[model samples]
Target: MKKVGTMLGNIAMYFGVFYALLYLLRSTYNFEVTLSFAKFLSRNQAMFMAVLFTLITLVYLLIFRIKGWIWPHADNNLFRVAGFRRLSAPRVWLMVGMGLAGSLFSIGLIVIDDIAQLFPSVPALVDDLIKGDSAVYVIMGAGILGPTFEELLFRGLLFRELRKVMPVYVALVLQAAAYAYFQPSMALSVISIGSGIIYGSLYLRTRSLWAPILVQITAMSTIFLLKYAGFYAWYDKLNEGVLYFITAVCLMALIGGSIYVWRTSDQGHDWIRVAKARMADTPSAAPKGG
Candidate 1:
C-alpha cells in the first residue's frame, strides 16, 4: 500500500512538473507580449503541445538517468533498462496489425452505437481537438509524441515501480487505474482505463516498451487518418444493413488479430532472462582466468 502511494505520488509529480512549467512559460512574458503569445498558442495549439511534450519527455529522461532510475549505472544502457530492446520483425508486424484492427473495431463500435454513445460529448470533443488543427501537428503530437511519452511513463516507469512490490496482474490494474485517474474527462478516463490495460499487457507480453508504443501510435494515427479522410461522413450515408455488415467484419478482424498477437507474443522469456542470456554470452561477463 505504501509503495502504491509512492507510485501515485510519482505520477502526480510528473504532471505537476509539466503543468508548472507550462504555467511559467505561458506567464513569463509581459502583459502585452503574453496576450499575443497566448493568441498564437491557441491558434497553433497542436504544434505548441508537441513542442511542450518533446521538452518534457527529454527532461524526464534526463532526470531518470541522473537518479539511476532508468540508466541504473555505468554498466547498464538506458534503452535496455527501459524495455527498448529489439523485437523480431514478424512480431513487430503482428503487434501493429493488432493495433490497427483494434482501432477499426473501436470505430465500428462507435458507428453501431455500442460504445461512444455512452459518453455523448466525447465525439464532439475529439472533433474540436483535431478537425481544425494542422494535419502534421496533430499527427505528430497526438498520434506519435503523445503515445511515446505515455508509454514511457505508464508502462515503462510506473509499471516497473509497481512490479517491484506486487504481482504482475495487480501492478497492471493499479497502473491502469492511475493512468485513467489523470485523464481530463470522464469519457477519456473510461477510455484510458481500457487502453491502459491493453498497453500494459502488450508491454508484459512482448517484454518491450516498443510493443505498446508502436501499437498505440498505429491505433491513434489510423483514427486520425480516418477522421481527416472524412470516413465518418461517408459512414453516415451508408444504410443500416451495410453498416452492420461492415462493423461485423471489423469485429471479426479484431478477434482474429487479438488471437494472432497472443499466439505470437514472446512470453517464454522476460527482459531479465534475455539480459542474463546476453550477459552470459559476453566475454566480459565470463569467468576471469586465474
Candidate 2:
C-alpha cells in the first residue's frame, strides 16, 4: 500500500509539474490565451510541451546530480526499468511495419465522428505550423519529440511504476487508463485508452522503449505526411463501401502483423530477467528513512 501511494504520488507530481510549467510559461510570455481551465490546453500545445519536457528533464538530471543519486548499473537503473534498451534488427523492422499499419488503421477510428471530434486540434496545429513556415519544426516536435516524451512518461514511468505493484496485465490496463485520463472528452478518452494499451504492449513485449517510441514516431509521421498530401480529402470522396473495405484491410494487417511480432519477439525474456533482478534488489534499495 505504501508503495502504491508513492507510485500514485509520482504520477501526480509528473503531471502537476507539467501543467505548472505550462502556466508559468504562459504567464511569462504574456500570451493572450485564456485563463479558463477549459481553454488552458491551447492548440500550440505540442511545441510548448516539447519545450517543457526538455526543461523538466534537465532539471531532474541536475537534481539527481546535486543529490548524489547515482543511477543503478546498466541492468537496474531507472532507464533500464523504464524499457530503455535495444532490439534486434528484425524486431525493429517489425515494429516499424506495425506502426505503419496501425496508423492506417487509425483512419477508421478518426472517421468516427465522436471518437475524433476532440482531436481536430492535432491536425489544426499541424496545418497552422505548416502555414507559418514551420512545417519541419512541427514534424520534429509532434512526430518525434512529442511521441518520445509521451512514451517516456506514460509507457516508461507510469507503466514501470504500475508493474512494481501489480501483475503486468493489470498494470497495463491501469497505465492505459492513466494515459487516457488526459483526454478532454469520453470519446477521445476511449481512443487514447486503446492506443495506450497498444503502446504499452509494444513496450513490454519488446522489453524496450525503442519499440513503442519507433512505432509512435512512425505512426505520427505517416499520418502527418498523409494529411499534408491531402489524402484525407481524397478519402472523404470514397464511397462508404470502399472506405469500409480499406479500413477492414488495414485492421487485418495491423492485427495479423501484431500477432506475428508478439509470437516471434524474444525481448520479453530480457524483461523477465530484469524483473527478477528488480525483485531481488527491492528490499535493499528501499530508503532507510532514518
Candidate 3:
C-alpha cells in the first residue's frame, strides 16, 4: 500500500506538471506560438516553470501533511538530506569545471547537427515565440522560476522519495530519464539525462541539494544569456567542418579538466564517502533536541 501510494504520488507529480504546463500553453497562447516559445522557455522560462511547479507541489505536499497522509516531522530527515555543508574551494572549482564540460557537451551536439545540416526545429520555434513584446515573459519564466522549482522537486524531493524504493544509481537514472523526457526536445532530453547524472551524483556525494541547485542555476543562466545574445544561433551556424571539429576538441578538453579537478579536490573524497554511506545521519550530527 505504501509502495502504491508512493508510485501514485510520483505519477501524480510528473503528470500533474506536464498537464499543467500543457494547459498553460494551450490556454495562454496559440499552439504554434507556444510551440515556438517552448524553446525560449526551455532556455528562459524553464526556471519559472520549475519554480511554479515546485511551489504547487509543495502545496500538495502540505495538503497531504494536513490530512495526516504524510507527516512533516516524521520524514523531516528526508527533506533535510541536502546537508548544509559549505563546499571547499577545490570542490567549488571542480564543480565549475564539470559544469563547463556539461555545457560544452551540449554545445558539441549542436555543432554536430550543424555539420550534418540536422538542426533541430525547437530553436526556430523558440525564436518565433519571442518575436514580439512578450519576450520578457520568456526571460522570467526560464531564468528564475524554472531553475529554483526544478531543483526543489526533481533533485530535492523526487530523488529523495525514490531512494527508498530503488538502488541509488537506479533511482538517479530513472529520475534523470524522466526529467529529460519532459523537455520534449531530443537534444535537451539527452542533455537533461546527462545533467541528471551529474546533478544526481553531486547530490549523492554531498548529500546537499544546494550543490546541484547551484550548478543547475549556473547552467540555466548561461543558457539564457547564450540564447539572449544569439550565441545559440551563432553556434548553430558554425556546426560544420573545421569549426565543429575544433569545438568538439575543446569540449573534450574541458570535460577532462573538470574531471581532473573534481577527483583531486579534498571534498571529492568526502562527498564520495558520504554518498556511499547509509542514510543514518540526520541533516545535522547533533541530537534532535526534543
Best by TM-score: 2
| lDDT (0 to 1) per candidate | 0.67, 0.66, 0.56
Clashing pairs in 1: none
lDDT of 1 at 274: 39
Question: Candidate 3 regions off by >4 Å?
Answer: 1-51, 54-72, 75-86, 111-116, 125-139, 230-242, 249-290
In model 1, what is the error at residue 265, expressed in angstroms? Answer: 3.1
TM-score per model over all chains: 0.77, 0.78, 0.65
Query: What tens-digit string does per-residue lDDT give for candidate 3 at 1-290?
Result: 57547656855865576577556644534566566555544444443464456556565455445534454344343234334346676666656655555454545554466533464743543454344345455555554456556666677766665665556678789889877877756766865786676676676665556666666555555555566687776776663675566666755654464355445545435643443343333433311101
* Tens-digit per-residue lDDT, 1-290, candidate 2: 77778677866766776787767766744544435422333445556556667776555445435434454332233454456787888878877887787677666555544435657654444455444234565577677888888888888877776676666788889888988887655665776887788788777776678888888898887777777788877776777677667777876776676566667666335555555444343644222100
TM-score of 1: 0.77
Cα RMSD (Å) per model? Answer: 5.9, 5.4, 6.2
List the candidate 1 regions with Cα displacement exceeding 4 Å. Answer: 1-13, 25-31, 68-78, 113-116, 131-133, 241-263, 270-290
lDDT of 3: 0.56
The ten-residue window of minimal lDDT in model 3 covers 281-290
| Best first by TM-score, ranked | 2, 1, 3
What's the best-to-worst order under lDDT? Answer: 1, 2, 3
Model 2 per-residue lDDT at 33 = 47
